[model samples]
Target: MLVLLLLWTGCGSAVPPELAPDLILHNAKIITVDPDFRVVEAAAIKGSRFLAVGSNDHVLNLAGSQTSLVDLEGRTAIPGLIDSHIHALHFGWHITKHVNFSTGERLTVESMVARIGEWAKNVPPGKWIYARGPYSLDFVAEGRLPNRWEVDAVTPENPFFMNMQGHVGVVNSYAMRLAGVTKRTPDPEGGKFVRDPKTGELTGIVYEFPAMNPFRGLIPRHSLEDNLNAVRKANEVFNSLGITSVVNLAMPQWEFAVLRQLWRDEGLTVRWTAMLRADARVFLNKPYSEVEAEMRALGPPTRFGNDWLKINGIKIVLDGFVEAAYMREPYLEDIFGKGWRGILLWDRESLKSALRAAGKYGIQVAIHVTGDAAVDVALEVMDEVDREYPVAGRRWSLEHAGVMPTEENLEIAERLKVIISTQQSMGWSIGKTFKKWWGPEMGGIFAPNKTWLQALGHPYLKAGSDNRPINPFIGFWAYLARKDVDGEVAKPEEALGREDTLRLYTSNAAYGIFEEKERGSIEAGKLADLVVLSEDIMSVPEDQVREIKPVMTVVGGKIVFQQGS
Candidate 1:
């Protein structure tokens, strides 16, 4: 009996200890972005999760014989950035194909025409030629709309069209002819066909819904393979920038199908949460049981689909861009002394009904509300629905929340736990234009980010790039430095501290996506998703933040990207 007891004890002791980690990273400045926002020196990864995060000695001790060790070489590491709002497939498609007109001296119509003429000469004859990201209104001091004749002079045979802000476009005569639009073609409801004042002819400029439908039908439909290729290209760009996850703001049904195909094929690299476009009428009109069953069959909303993709929420655009004067607001006078109030896509009753129905189904809604008036209306609808359906923990978000929201609206949002998914880059990009239109007082009131800070006293605010060439670093700089893209400082008093700005991109963004508990921070038991930067962002001068580049990016314990040595 004594021998047996001793043998049993020896056997238990001989059971091999748990194996150590497969990877260890040490001698690094690691910004955890955790609850305490801790900074550590070393981190150990077992397979796809952080096993230990602490001192270099502690983390190194967990490294097994075959563990790959990475010396940080004095570089700085932070949590992998997750863009809260981006049009993933669209961005990919446009970047790969479209003629980017956002930059250069060719901002004016004449310059644009000259450039298009140059482009048309090289492309195949009769091919569908497309260009995007033009800002003709910016150059037209009188806010003159571009007409088909101007574009026709450049590419008469080519069906040329370019989107100004995703909500409006100007097409050439060929494209217009293909769409069968004429001067007498009545403007579709909820859309406007810009007309020549003297001739009363269609000018090829269209706004809101009407403009979108015709071209949308004519535009070459992306094949599943083409979309997958686009996704691959997008992932390469994102991983290069250390962006591991992104919330695709709005994806069309076909694009969603492509994403699903990529996921099934295990080809997706970046984690995605897709917001189904509200215009997906067929899906929205389906029976609740049918919809639920379809969603279930596809899969639940996930952070990474256990590896790559996720479907988080639905997106709805309530109004048009602020520049187009389509945002509902305190009416402002245009250059011609015409008072133009903004246009709402859906009537108040329709919006309210949709919100109520969405809330009932437990689907979080992300509504695009740019102007204060629009914000107020959205809040009112959300509040009404919350009173009835009462989503307890779901994080509904207000996209763009650019203008100053009312104190009452802020309070309600705080109480109901709605997130302000703002594009801080706007303060730099378009805030100057607002100042010109409304003057100092009203313009200052327009992007009253400070007002929200004071009213709600640190509400859940997430920073979004809006895919305007404003990455996390640019956003950080804008928020902390209070500087415009041109290096001019905005209202200094509205500027947030560096730490606060970081939180806006990291912790707050994660919270907005209902992913706060998993990947926002660097900690044990959490996914080892992080980025290493060439410079220490926290300690760098505010003006230099944009200069910093990602040196390395890790997702799910694997190094996905590394800057060329």
Candidate 2:
């Protein structure tokens, strides 16, 4: 009867059930993270939102006989963390795609070929042998990439392809032939088909995502059931980490559709907002004009979906990764040997036109940049587009701004009210590569979270794991402790405080997707998404931040995960 009342009264009309909370959590420290950052003793959840937040006595009094009561036993609770930027579908796809590598396994060509042989023998014919990671020849025992003849002997009956950190890739002759790779084939713009240095022959090595496009296109698509289960496993991992929300940039757009279906089935515990990647590379056959028309034709506009699933907008990756980031100055060394500043994905005027077309349609534009020069290009285009669309408070984002931050760029982003979605895990994953690859001055610019915090408040700066190592604590340790995988401090000067980091992961992340008013904090009338921690992240020593874990995670007033369960 009471559930019927809530259903009839709805979330509006201020249901008089304020005296009867559906769930009461007491005997715990509740970090409200409200305007005052108040720490309360208890919080009451009625339906999908917090009914009240106050002392234990105050909240327990509101609970009725039907209410679910849980004694937290003095655990610490905080707002559920949100990953501001993520490749959601990509994470799920690896599972369904039959990825062959395990976590932290050093890859080798012989191991890879053997794995392919095993799959061919055991898993039946016609399945593509696939694996991807930082699996370059650097790890192969021979210290060199296996050429076509070597791979063909094993993979002649099966197609085999493995990407190295999504940067470089090695494909077997069978896969190459199937994908129509010929010696006469011209390299795609901003991508390379690496040839043997001495022989001037095609070496079966591909550089950049654009170059791998044709080969990647050859892989057969997985089934809907396979994809659905993959996403379920992904969400379960996220729930265990206390992640209740994410801003997913589903590159292929198919992942976005599957997530919505999962949500409809009541299987998704994490609230997700999607940004369809606006990569012109995908439509290789279509002209730019047609692509622009499609951009303008994108339906329902930005922020069109509801709280659970929404269309955030489109993401335009203007440049490449660390070494390929378009820098203002030439690289200290010609790493790519392309006169090395960086590779620009799209040309200027044409990209500007694309931005205008999307902006004119009221589609929120999220531009990705990692270099100073790339930042300039993004800002100029956005500024011009903002004049027409008004970007202030529009939450137009600049993803991956940490690689090459400048005070000038920071000020411009601040003035335009652009959100900077950053990942410090780059520092962790890249490990000690910064100093060697980009020089000391460039390395210092890796991820200046403190500098970013000064330029843009906690609310304007968002934190995410990028894709790998989705544990928020692992990312937090990188930011707070400033250590790389080698246990060496990458840069001590750029470390962030726990409070600022927490806000970036929660309240600040909420604002990025326009969900700040609905969630991000533990105040009354806000969504009851929260985490019970084994140890207080704020109170723990800097080195121990990564040791903290979520005891339980709750989303939309229900416990989605518990450590023991």
Candidate 3:
């Protein structure tokens, strides 16, 4: 019957028919992440959807005379990669403008100071010297934190700076004085101000919200035009990595305005799903009517709004980074035996109330839960709220489900149907530090991907690059292959198989964003978002997976990225 339809379409003329298809790609290996996870050799595409998928000959036979053809030359193709969790604005902003501390041979305070001194020579004074991407604790045994004095030495007139793990930052004495933070300055409700015990002076090392707020205020506010430029640069980088879709976590209203402007100007080149940052109070109030009104005014969520933008849900940051002492877990030994178990953004009651409201309104919630204790609390809140509101179809996600929870908690997550938006790349990037700080017993509990997969029974979505570089391919390579970027296998036992890894980025990630039916996989009726890679990921040696480059990226039947072109 299928053959007959193809023959009839071919017999009429070279062209299949109007409204049939405008393009057909043949002679290729297409890994369609459909229900059966089919691997087809060719496909037929209309304006923005796949018309058919099967043998090359069958799809080619249905091609109309005017149908543009692409011969894949036996290259490998899969669904367009989606980075399920990334701070889109932050990622773009930092990459283009911030002082990158990731470049140095040694990521220490002293090394960073030297690097900034060099950067200061080229940059003018008085302007904020923004820098990011340094892991201070990665090298030193005591793990020396950079103080304002260290940064001041590099650029005393200029405000020298660098972020700690991209979550918090340290500014020089100049910046601190400008911000008016002094020894007497009390810590903000959700942030911290580190100080020297002897001198009673500000240390310049800020932790969590308090440390971040003041500095974020110091940076020059971006104009609408500047934001648009940032968006363009972001898209260029995304295309270079073959990323077709991204969920921009915690997009502010102001930034959304700029995105809208870009949409009107037709300047966007990447598909985005935005999660608005709902601060604690706003979210607790259950401001559904107001939020809905705002969304309606902004317009409905566009899957591929001109193939460049979309809005999926709302983001709620429940906790802070574990290493920064913002996590709720009890530290074994605090400095001077002064225990600090981190700060919770909101009380349990407030969290439950907000999440319940969000669930009732059909808005998906992406909660940041990093620590084991924090995860337990977050899960309890979700479970309690879910029981009351009974969200039938909403996909609630637990971002940064990094630390291993108790088996009972894992079972609870599976039962509650919560999606674990995890960072698989952390195994390679942050795993080392985890081993050191946590010791053997706790280190083993950090990011137990294999354990979660086994316990969850295949429902969790592996989707996070929260503070690291956003690259799904690299993530897949690391998680499945258990190898570093240089192809050195780390922990083979924790490795997921190739097929499961693909699902993590494709169907699993799509399900997390509530866009499973529209995107995520290649099916007859789904949007044609796909990527062509240099090698077959499944067939390659585990170590070499990182070397595979994306040769092409197509979204809605239009080619968005082509390697070296």
What would the TM-score be for candidate 3 when compared with the true structure? 0.88
Give the runs in model 2 whose Cα sits over 4 Å from its true position: 1-19, 100-121, 135-156, 182-186, 198-203, 281-292
lDDT of 3 by residue, 518-564 (tens): 77888887888888899998898876786788998888888888888
Off by over 4 Å in 1: 1-18, 103-111, 135-147, 184-187, 196-202, 280-307, 324-330, 334-338, 437-439, 444-446, 454-459
Worst 10 residues of 1 by lDDT: 8-17
Q: Kindly indicate the candidate among 1 and 2 with the higher TM-score.
A: 2
As for candidate 2, its clashing pairs are: 133-165
lDDT by residue for model 2 (393-484), tens: 77888887766576777777888888888787667666455455567666533577777788877688888877746788888877787765
- List, residue by residue over 1-565, the lDDT tens digit for candidate 1: 2233234334543212245667788999999988888999998887788877888865665555678899998788988888888877766776676676643122556667777789898777666677765433443433454578988887867887777657677788888888888888887865778888998998887776565588767878666677788788888788888788888887765677788887788756577778777653433455555545544443234332444666666788877665444344444555322566566665566676666666656667888887667788888888887788884467888888766566788788878777777777656655555566555554422345566655644437777777654366776776776554345665677777777777777777777776777787888888888899999998987779877899899988988899994
lDDT (0 to 1) per candidate: 0.71, 0.76, 0.71
TM-score of every candidate = 0.87, 0.89, 0.88
Worst 10 residues of 3 by lDDT: 298-307
Clashing pairs in 3: 14-64, 14-65, 15-64, 15-65, 16-64, 99-130, 99-131, 191-210
lDDT of 1: 0.71
RMSD of each: 5.3, 4.5, 3.8
Q: For model 1, what is the alpha-carbon lDDT of residue 486? A: 45
> Residue 433: error of model 2 in Å?
3.2
